[model samples]
Target: MYGIKTRLCLSVLFALTLISPAWAQTFDFGEIKSPILFQGNYKYAYRDPAVVYHEGKFHLYFTLVEKAKDKGMYWYTAQSVSEDLVHWTYPKIITPCDRNLNYSSPGNIVRKDGQWIMCLQTYPTPNKERFGNKDSRVWIMRSEDLENWSEPELLKVKGNDVVVEDMGRMIDPYLLEDADEPGKWWCYYKQNGVSMSYSYDLKNWTYAGNAHSGENVTVIRQNGEYVLLHSPRNGIGVKRSKTPQEWGEDEALLTLGQKDWPWAKRRLTAATVVDLTKEKRFGKYIMFFHGSPVNPKNPRSDAHNKASLAIAWSDDLKTWTWPGKNSQPK
Candidate 1:
């Protein structure tokens, strides 16, 4: 009887260990090759990267665009995992297949309650439209494990007073907790130059105002200041502010090796940074951004289909370095 009881206890403890989220575990990111992390082919295009490091593994969520069987393209929120930055698991599409609700562009992931919340946008380009119509809206999805996700729930960031259809076009939703105020959450989306909305719970939101910024905005708090990384015309632009409500000015515009990197010669945008400076093993800020292949004649040719994902790291936000490139900040 005693032996059986001990065996049962051991099994339960082992199971709990596997399910626990381990942020402290350190990893050795062996030799990172060319800055091009994931090379997109003619058929598959990867863009809008959002990353989270949990359980000692890197979870990468991005917009996966594939050519549809009949015509047009399908955008999906897909995920891939990696322990070392060099190798990654096969990507799995987490969203359903619907042209009208082409769910893509996962901005970032946050933990609330007991589940994980991810903010994204619906870029419906049905009928071969260039961009999402007025129906484009921001949303959030819940997940206990990062692998599986629940159906997206509309963010309604325009405020409860406004109707859903009247919210106007919005995309690239990022969630951040107010540093000065606890339990108060902020949702930043791109509408009229990066508008913001706040909510106590993730459900109801009250529209705040807008900031003069570019699209795909990801803000991080460092040393009591909010650091905003955004996409301008062809590169990632940086801005700093005392608070989230307002921004000061552009600190720098980073076009990391775009001239040398033909894969990213066309454009380098949608840059998302994960500051892991506290982690002793990895004491630098890691950034993931997608770049489009260059075309000398058109300069925009193969911009959509052959776009690829890339990585860069920085000790300070001003300077960045990536593998297969010179050590100097570009």
Candidate 2:
């Protein structure tokens, strides 16, 4: 059980720097090499890593989940940036998710009308959901710099009759800022599957609808298109879109082998893609996912940890690199 629970407060680590490892040159994997730029700890249920390269640093915000009196979700973000994607600085827990309230990390850090925005999955506290705020959904926050984040602000929305066994909580938000559609933006959240929307301002979101509902999702605009990478019981899938205006059908991008991969314990869940398709970042695409490939026959069935970060790539946004040996199984 967690000893202390902190509420919605933005924790920040400023100006983090990293250097290339000695094996930097020795490691290579297409445009991205081995000796990964970052290292993840299995200790914290590190899930849904949204990486954004700011200036010269790679800021990766992650979710920290633990079971208190009841299973509750909280988030803390960590950051490390490197000019060259070779080695990353030791990761530090920089931000805190609401320990009391259910505060989850949001999608892309966006700039709108010259102001920065942080879209987050604001879950009702266990007390509130079981008692009040039942119809409530997600929200957004405003930030000028990554250091300071605004309070969790509500999103104008309408709840649906859809839900999974009464675990009534809509979490894991991914946003696309000021979409190509001009002053508009798009956001997606996990509703046992997915809930997508279009918003002109960070607040006042117009619900576009649900995408079947899953555990985690990563929606991105890549190579002149919109794509969704998600985890349904079938493993990890790669979805595509024709333009930022339309999100197309999703297909499994790749699957992790049970005993073959060590980093996973269950099927993939809570996955997300890079911040955006821009110049500050180099690689064609960078993604992080959750799951552990559990060996069905192993009596140590309990050895599985339940989450891990998976990697994948895409150039034209139509097809993604087959995530195979590249999977870092712990």
Give the number of the best model, judged by TM-score: 1
Return the TM-score for each candidate structure.
0.89, 0.67
lDDT per residue as tens, model 1, 1-330: 459889999999898778855444454444786788788887888999999988678999999998766657888999999876778888899998888999999999999888899999999987866677889999999999998899899998888889988899999999999999988999999988889999999888999899888899999988889999998888999999888888757899999888887778788999999988987657789999999886666765546777799998988888888875665346
In model 2, the Cα lDDT at residue 268 comes to 53
RMSD of 2: 12.8
Per lDDT, the best of the predicted structures is 1
* Cα lDDT computed for each candidate against the true fold: 0.87, 0.54
Candidate 2 vs. true structure, TM-score: 0.67
